[model samples]
Target: MIILGVDPGLTRCGVGVIEAGAHRRLSFVHVDVVRSSPDMSQDLRLLAIYNGLAAKIDRFAPDTVSIERVFAQENRNTVLGTAQAAGMAMLAAAQRGIPVALHTPTESKLAITGNGHALKPQMERMVARILGLNEPPTPADAADALAIAICHALRPAGALQGGEREQHLTPAQRQWAQAAQRSSGRGRRNADRGM
Candidate 1:
């Protein structure tokens, strides 16, 4: 399976493509940082990101697109730009009917380095080791994209098929499922209390 992972940003969106083989093996196919000038108009910058991702989607014909889920931060502008780029990535995959999977940074880090709070250098090193590269992929964004893809690649087959077989889930999936359950449980509790 060919998977395209996107680390979205308006100024430097990182994209990584990998081919997943039998038995959880993964091979790197491509890595790039799509850049848009900060001086460019907002709409134009967005268009450039969209076009860049679309071209790659066309070139790779990825089976699935893995993208970093947008999270809130102190800088609202950064968050907005990131969310926009993420939307472009989703749009590019949607145009080709390719499924898109959103993975949180914590999830990716945990899957890649076995630590949800891993630092950037650690993630880069792990990603390099996993792909059998001589060195880590340059510019943190590129490595981050690859890590996201690896995280998705590591998921158990049953998880990919929409099965909730806890025993078949990887650590990342188990954590995500537990988090989801906790959030839903809170909602159920609130409903019970007539909130």
Candidate 2:
């Protein structure tokens, strides 16, 4: 399975694509950071994110998308942009009839590093080790994206057997599932329109 993972942010959204084999081993396909200038208007910035993610989706043709769930932060503005970028990711996946999974920060960290509170350096190290990269991916965000993908790829079977009926999902994950359903039709329509 090919999985695309996104660490969404208006200024520096991170994207990573990985392919998993029958033996559960993973290989890196691509890693990138999509940047939008702070000086750009909100709509323009969001457009950049949407277009960039859409292109990645088309290029990678991932089987599924794994995205980091947005959490409340002290900075409301930051949180809002992150949520918006995340929405763009979902839209890109849904447009292609791809399923989306949302993983919490702690969940991703634990999946990769065996520690919920692992630091950035530790997480990066594990990501490199798991992918057998000579060095960790740069800019932290990229590494985080890769980690999110690995988390979903390595998730226990019990969690994914029920489709969207999986239990213990966070509110953000449930919301993503619903949006993906709604967007599935929209995706076809958009494709018809050459969007």
Candidate 3:
């Protein structure tokens, strides 16, 4: 399966594409950070994020798009920007009819590094080793994007199956499923409104 992972941020959104095969094998396809200057207008920054993600989706044609779920922070401004960036990612995926998954930072860390609270350096190292890269993907955000993809790639097939099987999902996976449902619902509502 080909998965595109996004680590969304106002200033620097990390994007990574990976191909996963059976037996837990994973290979990197692409990784980069989409940057917007802090001095730019908020609308322009968001536009850049949206366009960058859209272009990547078109170019890579991922089977699914996985984004890091936004979490509340003490700094409300930072949280708001992250949320907006994440929304851009979801919008791009939705526009293309690609399935989307939202994974929490802790969930991705645990999946990649075997610890929910793994440090950034440790997480980077693990991502590098898992993808067999000589070095970790540059910038912390890029590594994070790759980690999100790896997390979804490692999930059991049944976890993604709907209905009773979904009940067995871990808390993080359940959150992802709920977010995906909400996204699809919003798309339907937008279509109803002729958006």
| lDDT, residue 22, model 2 | 86
Segments of candidate 3 deviating more than 4 angstroms: 157-195
Which runs of model 1 end up more than 4 angstroms from their true locations? 156-195
Model 3 lDDT at residue 74: 29
**Quality of model 1 by C-alpha lDDT:** 0.81
Worst 10 residues of 3 by lDDT: 186-195
lDDT of 2 by residue, 76-180 (tens): 769889989999998888777788888778888888888899999999999998888989987666988999999998886665523334223566886776578
With a 3 Å backbone cut-off (N, CA, C), the pairs that clash in candidate 3 are none
C-alpha RMSD by candidate, in order: 7.2, 8.4, 7.5
Using TM-score as the measure, name the better of candidate 2 and candidate 3: 2
On lDDT, the candidate that comes out on top is 2
In model 1, how large is the Cα lDDT of residue 193?
A: 27
- Compute each candidate's TM-score over C-alphas: 0.80, 0.81, 0.80
